[model samples]
Target: MLSRVAPWLASRNENGLGVRVLGGADTLALRALANEDAVANVFILAHLESTGTAAPTSGGASVFGVFDGDTLLGACWAGANLVPVQLEPGLAGYVANAAHQTGRRYASIFGPAETVLALYSRFEQLGHLAHEVRADQPLLSISGGPAIGANPDLSFGSMADFDRILPACAAMFEEEVGYSPFLGGQEFYSKRVAGLIRQGHSLVHIDAQGTVIFKAELGAVTRDVTQVQGVWMNPELRGRGQSAGYMAAVVNLSRTFAPVTSLYVNDYNTKARATYERVGFEQVGTFATVLF
Candidate 1:
């Protein structure tokens, strides 16, 4: 089990942590809090920067939190993504109830493992199944650049290669997410993949026949860090000593966008973790994902 929840931000006065919706004026404090652990907070910070408000009233979602006087102890984003960051058990329970009360739909709940588990337990008790729960996934981050030789085969994918790469992308999504991105509809997810391709975020390694051998993407980006996700290798290519070096190539490629590259892997996945370690990723934290 993770350590007991800390009192860093949740209790600073006789009043204790006060829970409420964060407003636009809280933006500066939010950024400062996010900067404490840039890699872990990148998604929230990026969303905040994009929307200019902690709680965007225009359509996405809102940020609710537990604050100690004026210091933010932890916060939860109840938006399209449904993320919680650095939340302790008490704060997490509060946020979980808040999410239920608001009745907003979200895709996933992922962040620090303990907080995620805490929040998910509350949500589950409230009748949400959280169909798939990935607990104890190691969150890894690499600063600077790749420490090993890059795979000569890798390249940034492009719009022109969309049709060629779409199948590979779909395969990776299903394999990792346990469901096809096209489950609800193809157009939205297709456009999302295409948008990443247009931004030169998709990295691919192809064979002589032009079939994708391995592929991944810079899935999320912030000023100081970018997260690499959707990593997949051809089944035929597995256990061939090729993955680590290929991941090195991906990390080096990702450096063009941000100095740090981050990703999380299942704790049970020894092979993938080994590949990432061999390629220079260090476990900085742990993440959990409650997939509904």
Candidate 2:
């Protein structure tokens, strides 16, 4: 069986549509295909742009590719967060066999549903466990939409707002992922918050006491797409019916940075989905996530 399965072996370049870990020499090929589906590939592209195929010393992350005789066909990035980013399909078996040896066990696997599912199924067939599978997330996008509404209090977050925004960010992460992001350690997460604030990527609405009531971050921006993430509202404020208006405000603010604003949400998130619809986002594709 080992001999028969050798064609898809990873970490080395081989003949035909084989699997191998990518390196600096593969940068141009990887970047071309990653940009071909920029929104879906942003996580990997963001890494590739910074490190350019050089494996980082501390990030505990690596990118792998499936090549058709050295021509790239697909790639996947496994990183410190454990959310393996699926960039293309047609290499499920390759990813399945390569996951553990290429990187540590992950928290989740996410991407376009069809590809994510294909990879997850193959991965699990080899005995990995999935704590949850969000198999039908709607990938939404907006461009040239109707004018967005405004909220007097909703505005971009700054260094001044960092302390106030961090708790809300932690709350949102816990609620969405079933655990506090602070579990690992405060320093890494804290640095992430500060970095986003410094870059003007965070937005929030604060009250008189400087409590953050609404928060979101511009998570990724590339020439082809921009993504919004970490959206949250103070739980006590819910059912007062303010989310729709504030979300629209974000949509308007978002377009200034990129012509297209995109995000993916679990299919069961009816309220969030409705708010996005009201804000002019349309479901352009489906995504899936497997949480471990």
Candidate 3:
């Protein structure tokens, strides 16, 4: 049986390691655990806290844990996306045993620095490929850019717009999230879009042709920060640099509600990454997503 660790953030030693789900009130503590510079849990905790969804299955969900036998080590929860664990040195055996016990197959994994190589080698021994390298680059804005201007027909979308927006929204989800919202359903997708609209964070750009050609939505928002998400341009217009301008415009527009803006991109996506850099986003850190 796995040892149960208390969920209190303040109770952690930064030296004791185990995995347990902290209840709702304990989220702040989880946030504290993430703030530790040495082992900041990024996507795992952010999604857990933001979306309040956590399920551990071979092909879904994400889970995180702290390893405290010596130094406090925080690892990202890739769930069943990759085998065993995303970050490791301590407890690879434990992760493997757990996955085995549950009959799950972890196809591959990713992590930061040498830690990734070590885990990769172990998974290779377990018969999975260390075949690819992936990086989740975190981006934050630094210095100059106008907050708001050139308001190009900005307006909040109503539910009435869903019929028209569904196709593009679903496409954005597939491209950015790596999954289709249909599998998750329309309600979840609609709620997500509505939330952004309510916050005045979803924007669309239409050309003189009256075609809705560009769109971007907020994934996360706070008093000081708004994350650009679901960014897309109609496929027919892919060759043009329309996305970059819309991104800048979104940043400019969102600043009215939030002061700092940030987002993440897959490292292999050099095109989108370059566009973000051109519009003034600086790489602040890295993150990863493990797909089973």
Candidate 4:
């Protein structure tokens, strides 16, 4: 594990700018930096609040920081996916270079549009190409009650609905990522869905025949915001006018955990975008994703 992070530890530029693995002592500074844009940095903030700044002993994930002297300027969550937080566009190349030196293969890189794309550009220069680049995802959020009526049928999922919900989740993942999430094994993905259900993070509207009508998960959450993901409506039900109500219900239900509800949608998803707008969400920023 030390060897995995050694390159970052030893790298420092002439201008006092450097990238290194963050430790527990850096928690306060890191949290402060993430708070600069709570909605955009909610994922890292949630992780920090839950897990602190210590890197995992298994070498699975670690927070890397960019600093000038002792001041924290930006950071990146180097794990299954690289998530940049408050990373300045000009400094992205440094972070990407350090990440490349670690020889870690990330599944994706995602976050604010400018930072993600800048980081991806540096990665591309390092010969780390992406399978796809979604460069214009709108990051939408809502802080008050939704504009439409809530769906009466939508409810938080439970273990009893797991059988139906898991397939819908997998379908959404496959549709979005261009591969089945179950390709490696079902256990990991199954546990993830089950955990979200158990934690009351999974929301769904299952029909009488046990078919999922609509589903979405609060993938990243904090007291201030909940980032929605894996949102899906049954293919058979897509053309109906029910999406707005269902999404309104999602916003209403999600507020129980956090005041602000947020989710990013691909620029090409006009229907979802329209439904979200109808439900009262407004674009706060742009996000980008580089799928590996």
TM-score of each: 0.90, 0.87, 0.63, 0.94
lDDT of 4 by residue, 72-159 (tens): 9999989889999999867777789878998999999999988888888878767888899998999999998999899989999999
Q: Whole-model Cα lDDT per candidate?
A: 0.82, 0.74, 0.55, 0.89
Which of candidates 1 and 3 reaches a greater TM-score?
1
Q: Model 3 over residues 195-271: C-alpha lDDT tens digits?
A: 66665667776556656687777665554556666777899989787567767777777777567666767777888
Please, what are the lDDT tens digits per residue for candidate 2 over residues 46-104? Answer: 66665666344365566767667857777777664333344444466676667766547
**lDDT comparing candidate 4 with the true structure:** 0.89
Off by over 4 Å in 1: 1-16
Candidate 2 lDDT score at position 130: 82
Question: Who is ahead in TM-score, 2 or 3?
Answer: 2
In order of lDDT, best first, we have: 4, 1, 2, 3
RMSD (CA, angstroms), candidate 3: 7.7
Give lDDT: candidate 1, residue 158: 84
Q: After superposition on all CA atoms, what RMSD does each candidate show versus the true structure?
A: 3.1, 4.2, 7.7, 4.8
TM-score of 3: 0.63
Query: What residue pairs are clashing in model 2?
Result: none
Q: After superposition, how far is residue 192 of candidate 4 from its true place, in Å?
A: 1.2
